[model samples]
Each structure stands twice: as structure tokens, then as C-alpha cells.
Target: MDFYLTALLQGLCLSGIALGIYISMKIFNIPDITTDGSYTLGGAVTGMLLSNHLPIGIVLPVVIIAGGLAGVFTGLIHTKLKINPLLSGILVMTGLYSINLSIMGRSNIPLLNYTTLFDSFHFIADLNWNSLIVLLFIGTLLILLIGYILKSDYGITMRATGNSEKMVSALGVNIDRIKIVGLGFANALTAVSGFLMTQFQGFTDINMGIGIVIVGLGSVIIADTFINWMNISSIWISLILVCLGAILFQLVLAFTLSIGIDPTLLKLITALFVLSIVSLPRLNLTRN
Candidate 1:
């Protein structure tokens, strides 16, 4: 039961990242590889700042802005420079590798003994309620914010840009601007997630973001599948499915570990799970 609860908390942390990716992939219709770098970028910046005794309140927004800036760079390369979105994302991600290294000044940053947002929970240590409460608070705030964004006019423009850039342009909307804004917002959310994750885990590894895009896509796919995409009604429901998908994914992983599964095989299992979900719809189509 303790493990399950722990996994649930971890899932909430991961769900933030998944939501960010969904904004880019589903809402913006852009295959963004920049998440691989931006995720760690957020962690590195947050961890370094917090280690230097910066307040969590300040560090959070700074890391989010930093991630947004990274996304803008990628968007500019794609929209202004006429580069393919996929290639643009790859280039930006590759560049961020060096950028993240420079920010951390090392391969990793340790947050041991550092006072973080979670440290305030020491007052309630008798109940051991800090981490769970914090996770739920952050998760709920993010979901509400995302839901609000998806209902706004700008959000509709973003969706239009994703589905048909030329059509949006024909309608007098600056598609380039929409792409940049959407990408920036998407990465900002990802950064916040990374910030929370590092503070919660007490360390930041440069390679922590590896395979993050896959994980994000897997969560979205799983959620959409379970919720029956056609039945999705509002932004709130979409956000809920995304969160549930991430939590369920983590639960599966926790169960596998409890059964003595090799840690190295975990990636294989994740890949298989994603593959199965992705293939299910196609298989059904063929059967029909």
C-alpha cells in the first residue's frame, strides 16, 4: 500500500510532463523532441538555483520561463527559418544538451540537505503528509490551468494551427506566432514538472530526461484509448484522462518491480506497452 501511494505521487509528478507533451503533440500537432532536453533543462536550472538557496517561488517561474524560451528557439527555427518541425525540434534538443550541461556545471546536481518546498512539510512530519499534499496541490493547479488554456481563443488558434496551418493562415491568424506561443507554453509546463520532480527526488541527473517523449506519448495514448477519444467532452475530462493515464502507467511499473522484474527490462516493457496501445486501434480496424 505504501508503494502504491508512492507510485501515485510519482505519477502526479510525471503527469505534468505528460500534459505538456500532450499540449504540443495533440493540441499543437507538433512532434516535439525538445522535451527530451527541456525536461532536464528545467531540473538543472531549478536544482542549481535551489542549491544556491533561491526561494522555491522564484525558482519555479524562472525554470518555467527558461523552458519556454527553449521552446521559442525551436519554434523560430521551424517557422521563421522554414525548417521542418521535426528537424527543428531535433536541432533545438541537441543544442539544449550543451546548454543544460553549462547550466549545471556538471553531469549532475545533488540537492541533499537543501531546503526545498517539501522542507516546509517538516511541521507536519508526524503525519507524513507533505509530499502527497504537495503533489496533489501542484497537480490540481496544473490541470485547472491547462483546462482553462484549452478553452481560450488563443487555445483554439493553437489547435487550428496544429490541424491546418495553411487554413489558420488563410483566416488571417499568424500561424508562426501561434506555433511559437504553443510550443513555449508547452515547454514551460514541462519545466515546472521537472522542477517539482527534482525537488521531490533530491537530485538531478542530466540523463533523467531520456525517453521522456516516449513516456509522454505513451501516457496520452493510454489515456485516450481508455477514455474512448470520441467520448471526450471537455478540457477537464481530457486533463483527467491524461493524469489517469500517467498514474496507471506508474502503477504498472511499480507492480513489475515488486514482482522482482529486472530494472533494465523496464524500458522494454514500457516500449511493449506503448506498442500494444498504439496497435490496438489498427488491429480493431482490420478485424472490422
Candidate 2:
């Protein structure tokens, strides 16, 4: 039971990143790989600030802004320099590796003795339960916030930019500006995930964000599958499904572990699962 509960919390932790990826891939139609670096940058910033006794309030905004800046950098490269979007993300992500290292001043930072966002909550007696409650609240709030934004006027423009960039441009909208803001917002959410995970795991590792993009992509794919099947058109419902998809993804991993799979094969399993999710939907369409 505890194992499963942990997986639930883990899902909540990853929810922010999943939303970030969804915003980029689904809304903007941009494969913003900057999530890889921005996630770790969030952890690095959080860990460094907490270890230095910084206020939690200050720490969070700083981490979010840092993540946003990284996205802005990638957006600039792609839009201003005319670099391919994928290559621009790669360049920024690669640079963030070194930046994260410098921020941490080490390869890892332990937070066993420090207070975290989980410490402020007491809705449950068990540590894990309390953590779960806090995570659930935060996750719900984030999903609502994103959902609201996506249903707004600016969000219409952002979504339109992805769906018909040429048309939006023809309307005298600054496509480049929209892309920058959208990407920046996406990465900021990714960074929030990193911040939460680092605190939950009790340590921050320089390489923790490695391949995190894949996890986010998998969650998005899973969410997309369910959303399509339900034929849900409400933005709020879509956002909720995205978070549920993250939870479902984690639950699958937990079940896999319960079955005694070799830990070394976890990455392979993740890759295979994501591949299946990506392919199965198209296969179903073909059969229809």
C-alpha cells in the first residue's frame, strides 16, 4: 500500500512537467526539449536556495523565473536566429547542464535536514500521506490555473499560432512574441515539477533531469489517449486528464516494480511503453 501511495505522490510531482510538455507539444505544436534542462535547473535552484536558508517564498519565484529565462533563450534562438526549433532546444538544454552544475556547486545536494513544501502541511498523520495531500492541492491548483489561462483570449492566440501560424501572423499578431511567451511559460511549469521532486526525494542530483523529457512526453501521450476516447472538449477536463495520465503512468511503473522487474531495465521499459502509447492510437485509427 505504501509503495502504491508513493507512486501516487510521484505522479503528482511529475504532473507539472507533464502539463508543461502538453502546453508545448499540444498547444504550441513545439517539441520543447528545453524541459530536460529547465527541470534540473529548478531542482538546482531550489536545492541551492533551501540549503542556504532562503525563504521558500523567494525560492519558488526565483526557480520559476530561471526556468522561464531558459525557455526564452531557446525561443530566441529558434525565432531570431532562424535555428531549427529542435536544434535550438538542444543547444539551450546542453548549456543548462553546465549552468545547473554551477548553481549546485556540486553534483548533488542532500536536503534531509532542511524543511520543504511538504513540511507546512498536516492534513494526514503519515509523512507520505501528508505529502500526498500537499501535492494534490498544489497539483489541483496548477491544473486549474493552466486551464483558465488556456481558455482566455491570449491562450486563443497562442493555440491559433500553433494551429495556423500563417493565419495568426496575417492577423497582425506577433507570432514570435507568442511563441516566446508560450515556451517560457511551458518551461516554468517544468521547473516547478523539478522543484517539487527534488524536495520529495530529499536530494537534488545534477543528472536527475536526464531523460525527464521522455517521462513528460509519455504522460502527455497517455493523457491524449484518454482525452481522445472520452471526446472531452472542455479545457479544464483536458488539464485534469493530463494530471491523471501522469498518475496512471507512475502507477504502471509501480506495478511493474511490484512484479520484480530488474531495476536496470526500467528505462527500456519506459521507452517501450511510450512507444506503444504513441503507436497504438494511430493503429486504432487505421483499423477504423
Candidate 3:
């Protein structure tokens, strides 16, 4: 039970990344492979900054900006150079692999001796409550922030761009600018998630982001499947479903591990789970 609770908290803590994935894949209709690398970029930047005695409050925003800039570069390649979005994402992700290495000066950074958000809640550590409490706060804040953004004028333009670039452009909206802003925002949120995750886990590894896009897609697909995407009457509800889906995914992982499942098989399990969720809608359609 304790282990399950821990996994649940960890999932909640990483909900920011899931939300970021939702923005890119669902809101912007972009399948960004950059997330798998930018997540590590966030951790590398945050861990390096924290090691240099930088305050979390300051370093956190910087990490997010760094991630955003990475996304902007990818967007530029796609929009300006006519590169495919998938290929552009892969190119930027490949570049970030080297950049993250350069930032850390190594493949990983240990945060054992550094102060972090978890340390600030040391008082609750004894009770095993801090992780859950902190995750709840961060997850709630992210959901609210995303909901607000989705309702804003800029957000509407972003959605329009995703729905129909030609229509949005005909309406005098700068579709390229919308794509840039949307992708930038998506990567920034992903970076914030990476920063918070390193703080929680006490270490950052360059390869930690391996298959992260699968995990994020799994979470989003699970949310859409369980809630019946059509039932999501508002953006807020959709965000909440995404968070819940992440928690559920973690719980499933925890359960599998408890049953002596090989931990290394997690990526395979994530892929299968995503496939099942994605096929659910089609199954219903075929049955009808």
C-alpha cells in the first residue's frame, strides 16, 4: 500500500508533463517527439543550476524558457524551412541530446546533497505526506493555468490553427506565429515537469527521458478512453481527466511491479496500454 501511494504521488508530480503532451498532441495536433529529449534538457539545466547554488524559484523559470527555446527552434525548422513536424521534432530532440550532455558536463547529475522542493517539505517527510501534498498543489495549479490559457484569445487562435491552418490564415490570423507560440508553450510545460521530477527523485539522468513520449501518449489516450472524449464538456474537465489518467497509469505500473514484473518491461507495457486506449474508439465505431 505504501509503495502504491508513492507511485501515485510520483505520477501526480509528473502530471505537468502529461498536460504538456496534451497541449501538443491534442490542442495543437502536433506529434512532438521533442518531448522525449526536452524533458531531459529540463532536468540537466535544473540540476546544473541547483548544483551551482541557484535558488529553485529562479532556476525553474529558466529551465522552462530553455525548453521553450528548444521547441521554437524545432518550430522554425518545420514552419520556415518546410521540414516535416515529426522530422523537425526528431532533429531538435537529437540536438538536445548533445546540449543536455554539455549542460550537465556528464550523463547524469546527482541531487543528493542539493536542496530541493522536497527538502522544503522535510517536516512532512516523516509522515510520508509531503510528496502527495506537493503533487496535489502543483497538479491543481497546472490544470487551472492550462484551462485559463485554452479559453484565452491566443489559445483560440492556437486551436483554430490546429483545426485548419488555411481557415485560420484566411481569417487573418498568423498561423505560423500560432504554431510557434503553441509549440513553445508545450515544451515549456514539459521542462517545468522535468525540473519538478528531478527535484522529487533526487537525480537527473540524460537517458531518463527514453520513451517518455509513449508514457505521455498513454496517459492522454487513457484519459480520453475512460472519460469518453465527447463527455468532456469543458477544458477544465479534460485537464482533470488527463491528471487522473496519469495517476492511474502509475498505479498500474506499481501493481505490475509488485507482482514481480520486470521493471525494464515498463516501456513495452506503456506502448501496449496506449495502443489499447487508441483502439477503443475505433472498436466502438466498428461495432456500430
Clashing pairs in 2: none
Rank candidates, lDDT, best first: 2, 1, 3
Over 4 Å off in model 2, which ranges? none
Q: Rate the local accuracy (lDDT) of all candidates.
A: 0.86, 0.93, 0.85
In candidate 1, which residue ranges exceed 4 Å CA deviation? Answer: 121-128
Arrange candidates by TM-score, descending.
2, 3, 1
TM for every model, in the order presented, reads 0.95, 0.98, 0.96
Q: For each predicted model, how many residue pairs clash, with residues at least 3 apart or on different chains?
A: 0, 0, 0
lDDT of 2 by residue, 1-288 (tens): 999999999999999999999999999888998999999999999999999988789999999999999999999999999998899999999999999999999999999999888876678788998998899899989988898888899998998899999999999999999999999999999999999999999999999999999999999999999889889888888888889989998999999999999989999999999999999989999999
Counting only residues 3 or more apart in sequence or on different chains, how many pairs clash (N, Cα, C under 3 Å) in candidate 1? 0
**TM-score of candidate 3 versus the correct structure, residues matched by position:** 0.96
lDDT of 1 by residue, 4-34 (tens): 8878877888887789888989888789999
Candidate 3 per-residue lDDT, tens place, 1-288, comes to 789888887788668778888888888788999998889989999899999889878898899899999889888888999999999999999999999999999888999999887776654745348767777887888898988888998887787778888898999988777888788888888888789889878899999888887777788888877667567667888899998988888898889889998988977877777787788799989999
Top candidate (TM-score): 2
